[model samples]
Target chain A: MNLNVYLHAFTGVVKREFWRFIQQRSRFLSALVRPLLWLVVFAAGFRAALGVAIIPPYATYITYETYIAPGLCCMILLFNGMQSSLSMVYDREMGSMKVLLMSPVPRSWLLISKLLAIALISLVQVYAFLAIAWLAGVEPPALGLITALPALVLVALLLGSIGLFLSARIRQLENFAGVMNFVIFPMFFLSSALYPLWKMRESSEWLYWICQYNPFTHAVELVRFALYQQLNLQALAITLGTTLVFATLAVISFNPERTVRAAPAKA
Target chain B: MTIALQIDRVSHQYGQRVALDNVSIGLVEGQFNALLGPNGAGKSTLFALLTRLYRVQQGEIRLGDDSINRNPRALLARLGVVFQQSTLDLDLTVMQNLEYHGALHGLSTREIRRRAAEELEWLGLADRTKDKVRSLNGGHRRRVEIARALLHRPDILLLDEASAGLDVASRQAINKAVRQLCQERGLTVLWATHLLEEISLDDPVVILHRGRVLAEGIGRDVCERSDETSLDALFDRLTSAKEAHA
Candidate 1:
């Protein structure tokens, strides 16, 4: 509860996260490579295959590469969030998580501090990807970068919280892959990551409405709008609201009071 | 003097398997007590409870009059823990690890540096302060963990088998340091181990077997019930009896 003590705990967790990322250079490289592949190879191949009609805040025609930048950003956050959460699970297995959990700090504050650390690292990775995108000539709105910063942080926090929540619930890594295929990919793809809602409408109005209500879609839209220097009230509301809700769920899922059913590790 | 830690009627279970069943113990100020149990005796579970890693379904844990469950942050503010696994960052220098731990305790920049220097010196690790933990031997790494745990001057110091992997020379050194801390600083120590030799007859010992406290009192009196001269024989008699009953 002491502000200074909280800051100290926060700083410790943050430093550990930063140190892990820096030491694992291959992880950073892979993160950059995935998005680059999408922009250079996948997006290029699909540009002609995927048709783009006029999307919101767009005054003119935009290429597929330009369209999926926000999606790619979301991808980076998703991957990193999952990676950190996996490490958290590993820590638990290896007994290091016990050390952190024992640190006389409130579980909620400790978790928030951890999320903030992960989000900060995710932000760095997203910006690096953005830099690479800029070089590839996928220009977002000039001022949108600054405005989108907050949105990007929010997206990272939401994803990180989900990752935390799932880690506490799922005791094994094998189960997580199921989550990735079933949950993460759908959340990313079903949202406006690769295509616009209007574009989805041409295919199915029902599907479009689902996308419209999807919290991740709002997350993407919030970032996309910010990248355009335009703030979508609905998107912001949805993103913030989803963050609050997911964060709450995440904290509840990890509350130590709820005894975990000890399961055997993967043999 | 205040009671450093008190656990009353705490029981925890993972599903139907009881990890700690109706376990209770008291650690008073400046007392160097050890928690002794066989591998599956729930020693780790008890440590988890003490450190707030595992919350008790029944009973309560207090740290110097504060309920750890209700005020974990306040409790942690004056607590230092060295788990069975090394929490040190292999990539971080010894100095960095201490500084990071110090920060969590709300120590100032000057205070962290000063304390790190003092702790390292106390543990005969002054020369390797800048070395990454990966570069150190198991003994040195254990020393670092112990030193780091003391950085905050916690009222209760919990070491979960802290000397498990050490060589004889290293174990002796670590034990000497622990003894020094207890004698000089009056730090309450909870040394959790399965090794009978680690328990001094003078220190209070709690014998846990199959998630239950088999016996707890001064090591001499607890071991006296058996016709064994050493603690290990007494431990064998106690645990084997539990297995036979099971």
Candidate 2:
């Protein structure tokens, strides 16, 4: 209950998470590589095939790589979010989750602090991927990087909390592959990550609407606008709203007293 | 002596399967109580409830003056637990694991460092403080976990079958270490074990079978009341009758 203890606990958890991220070099590498492949390989291949009209966020025409860079940055956040949840599931199974929850703090505070640490780590990967994108010539305005920081953080927190929310429901680690298939793919592909909603509409109107409905689309749009030094009020509003909603839901699901079996010992 | 922990009329079920049934026991401060049960006799369930890993289903659990229902978090601050399963992060060094636990318990870094060094030295593990848990043997990891549990200096320590997989020497060492803590520090200890030999004849014992308390008192006294010569005989008598009824 002491304020200093709460601060120390928060710092300890975050520092432990940061060290885990550092030790697992492969996880960090994949976080960057997954999105980099999209920006460097897929975008280049699609560049000739796709023509992006000057969207509101884009006053001038843009290359496919430039168009998808922000989405890909969000992709790193998305994957890291899921990865952190996977570790949560792993921790639950391995018994480390008990060590965490036993901390003399509110369960909501513990879970939110954990989510924030994950989001912070995800942001590091986001900025790292963005740097690589810039070098690869998927150029956003230099100052846009600074402006995009807040939006990028909001998007990461939103996705990370969503992942944390999903984690509270998963009983087994193997279930994560299913989450990637059902949650991650749908959120990404059905959003504006690969193509604009109008482009989806060119194929099917309902599918385009689903893309518009997907919160990832708004997150991507938010980052896309910020990266161009523009503030799309609607995107910002939707992203902020979704962040609060998902974070609340995640914290609620993680409440210890509700007592879903922390992890049943395998027979 | 003041009672450090009291459990009254507690029962729990998994769906329709009863795991604990109206079980009650009181542990005096600074006393070591062996929660003796067979594998499925609800020892883990009771430990789970005591540690607040699971909610109390049908009765009251009191730690010091705090009740589980009214002020559970306060109760938790006064209790420590070392689960049967290893909870130490295998990839983290002993110091890292202990320091994190200390922070969770709200200890300052300087205090954690001093305690960690003191504890590791006591466990004869000071040389291995920097070693990752994965690099240590099962016994060593268990030792580190015990140290971590004590780092917060809680009055009550609940150890659920804590010596389950250790070698005989390691198990006895762990047992001696805890018993010494109880005697010297007046730590209230609930040591859950299936191994009868881990308990002393004069130590308090709670024998649980078929989700109910079969016997609870001084170990040899329980044996004498049950008209048995040894704890092993008493335990077998109680549990087999359970299997026959089932």
Q: Supply the DockQ value of model 1.
A: 0.46
Q: Write the per-residue lDDT of candidate 2 for residues A1-267, one digit (tens) a residue.
A: 779978888878887898788879999898888998888788878888888989878889988988898889888889888887799888888888888877767777777788889988988888888888889987788999999999998998999899899888887899998999999999999999878888899999999999888999999999999998999899999999999999999987874533324323310
The two-chain DockQ for each candidate, comma-separated, is 0.46, 0.53
What is residue A239's positional error in candidate 2, in angstroms?
1.2
lDDT for each residue of candidate 1 in A1-267, tens digit (9 for 90 to 100): 458877878888898789778888999999999989988999989999897877786778899999899988988998888887787776666555655666666678889998999999999999999998999999886688899899999999988988887777777656778777876888877899888888889899999988888788988888888898888999888788888888899888885532222321100
Q: TM-score of candidate 1 restricted to chain B?
A: 0.95
Please list all clashing residue pairs in model 2, or write none if there are none: none
Over B128-243, each residue of candidate 2 has an lDDT whose tens digit, in order, gives 99898999998888889889988999989999889999999999999999999998888989999889999998898998887899999998888998899999998899999889
Q: What is the lDDT of residue A13 in candidate 1?
A: 84
CAPRI category for model 1? acceptable
The alpha-carbon lDDT assigned to residue B94 of candidate 2 equals 91
Worst 10 residues of 2 chain B by lDDT: B44-53
- Candidate 1 residue lDDT tens string, B79-178: 7888776777787789888887776666765788898899999899999998988999999999999888988888878888888888989988887788
Model 2 regions lying over 4 Å from their true place: A255-267
